[model samples]
Structures are given as C-alpha cells and as structure tokens.
Target: MNKKIEKCAILMVSTDLTQKQIAEELNVSVQTIINWKKKDEFIEFKDDYQRKYLNNLAAKAIRTMDKLLTSDSDQVRYNAAKDILDRTGYKPTEKQNINMSGSLANPYEALTTEQLLKLAGDDDG
Candidate 1:
C-alpha cells in the first residue's frame, strides 16, 4: 500500500495513543486504524510487541498474587490457585504454586486483624 500508511502503522504501535487519537492526528477514520490493528499489522513494532508481552506477564503475575493473597491456610491457597488457574487459563506448575505459598509469612493475616483489634479494645474511650 502507501508508504504513509505503513509509517502510520509503525507509529500507532510504538505510541500509547488510542485509535481515535492516532486517527485524529493522521486525519484518518478511526475505523481505518482499527482495521489495521485487527490485521495485527499495527502491532509489528518492536516496542509494541514488548509492551504487549510485558502487559501479559504483569497480568498473569497479578492473577497469581491474587490467588495467593487471600488464603487463610495452605489448603485454601492451593484451592484458590487451582480455581484461579482453571478460570484464567493459567498453567499451574507444581513449583509455582508452592513458591507462591512460600512467599507468605502468614496467610492468616486477615483472621488475625480482628483478634488484634479486640485485644487492643476501644481507644475512643
């Protein structure tokens, strides 16, 4: 196609601009920009590929953290991770789950919060 359009694709992938933003700047319709994206042509830039990969990894790490964060016990953590992986298409490496659980000093922190508060009693006296 046009060299201008090829350059536009590279620019769109390299920047954080939305389709509307790029379209407005390039004086093209948003639909045209979106069509470019759907063909994966716009995402061919090195920065764009890296950004997408990093975002995916961050998302998966966050999901694993979320699964590990809410547990009150080892069994609970195991169950939660299993459920989360099942729902999110995360593959559970045996070591990955075990490592996640190992990172917690106390998974029962939530249960202790109220007990600590009760021990402190009311300071509003």
Candidate 2:
C-alpha cells in the first residue's frame, strides 16, 4: 500500500531490472529489496501486476502469433501453428504414468474386512 513498495512491485514485474538495479532506482540498498522480496505484500503485488500486464498484452500476443504463422522459416511457422493449436485446445494427448506402489496385483482383493485389518496390523477386535 505504501508508494515505495507499490512502485517496487511494478518495476519488479514490468521490467527486466535486477533487484540491485531496482534498489538503485529506488535509492535503497540491495538488502532492502531482498528483504522486501520476502514479504507477502511484495509477492502479491508483483503477481497482481504481472497478471494485469500479461492480460493487457494478450491480444497483441495473439496477433503476433497469427503473424508468425506466415513466417519465412518453416520452423517458425510450425511453432506458431503449434502454439495456436495448443491454446485452442488441440494439444496432443499425453500418456499418463500410473504409479502403483502398493502391489503388482490387488494385494487385498481376496481379503475380507477382518483379514485386511489383520494385514494392516490393526487386529484390535
């Protein structure tokens, strides 16, 4: 909420300036920026500013991607096409890796409640 911290957050997200550079610009020590970076206020402000900045650029980015589709390089065109397809929900199907750590087969499939509890070392009945 303070002007200094708000300005710091804007600079952090909207520019490629390093923390040292931001500290220099703000007339603060690098350690000050480093300290501020760990604060919730700084993190929230930077994230909010970044979201707003990207949202504002979305249309321009789309236009650039569309233009790139006709680029002279085949790879560039293919990449642009692929990006557009991905954004439009035409992404390739991904193979999911199922991790079954318990057993190769259903370890307790043949067990009754009493037997399963016994296997689990919960035979308190």
Candidate 3:
C-alpha cells in the first residue's frame, strides 16, 4: 500500500521491464522488488491491473477485426468477419453427436426422410 510498492506494481503492469530493471529504475534492489511483489496488497493490485490490461487489449483486437472486414483481400475480409461472428456468439450450428447404450433395430427410424438425405449429403430427399 506504500507509494513505492504501488509504483512498482504499476510499472510491472504497464511495462515489459523485469523486476530487476524496475528496481534499478526506481533506485531499489531487486530483492526489495521481489519482496514487495509477494505481499498481498501488491498481488491484488497487480492482478487487477493485468486483468484490466487484457480486457483493453481484447477490445482493441475486436476493433481491429471489425476494421479488417473491409479489407481488399477476400480471404482476409472473410476470416475477420468469421472471427467477429464467432466472438459475438454467431457461430455456425454444429450437429450433436449422440451416443446410445445399445444398438437399435433401425438407427434411421427416428430421422425423417429429409433429415436422412441431409445427413447423407444427398442432392434429393
């Protein structure tokens, strides 16, 4: 909770500097940084900072994906559109795989004629 530990946690979250580097920058020994990092308050602050940082990064990535939807390359546009859809809970429906305890006399009995054709990838039902 001290100003020094707070600064250390902020540096640790905001930059790619190692603890030793941060200690040198802050005019403290690496041992001090390591010790402060192990404290409960330091841990809590660092975890919250990291979580917020990641959330911001994810937002940026989503924005980038949205921008990529207008790209000239068809493949890039398609992939970005798919990524956005997948992230926004618009994923393509997938057939469920059901397991039965025992074999049935006719496995296709439960399926309609159209359903059977669709499952077989048939041209006509």
TM-score of 2: 0.67
**Order of models, best TM-score first:** 2, 3, 1
RMSD of each: 15.1, 7.5, 10.6
With a 3 Å backbone cut-off (N, CA, C), the pairs that clash in candidate 1 are none
Candidate 2: the clashing residue pairs are: none
Q: Per-residue lDDT tens digits of candidate 2, residues 1-125?
A: 77888889999888999988988899999888888889998899889999999999999999999899999999999999998999899989875544477435554678899998898899894
Summarize candidate 3's per-residue lDDT along 1-125 as a digit string, tens digits. 78888889889888999988999989999999888878999999889988988888987887888889999999999999888788789989875555585443565889988898899999575
Best by TM-score: 2
Per-prediction TM-score to the true structure, in the order listed: 0.31, 0.67, 0.66
Candidates arranged by lDDT, highest first: 2, 3, 1
- The lDDT for every candidate, in the order shown, is 0.67, 0.87, 0.86
| Candidate scoring better on TM-score of 1 and 3 | 3
TM-score of 1: 0.31
Shift of residue 90 alpha carbon in model 2, Å:
2.0
Among all windows of 10 consecutive residues in model 1, the one with the lowest summed lDDT is 92-101
Give the clash count for each candidate: 0, 0, 0
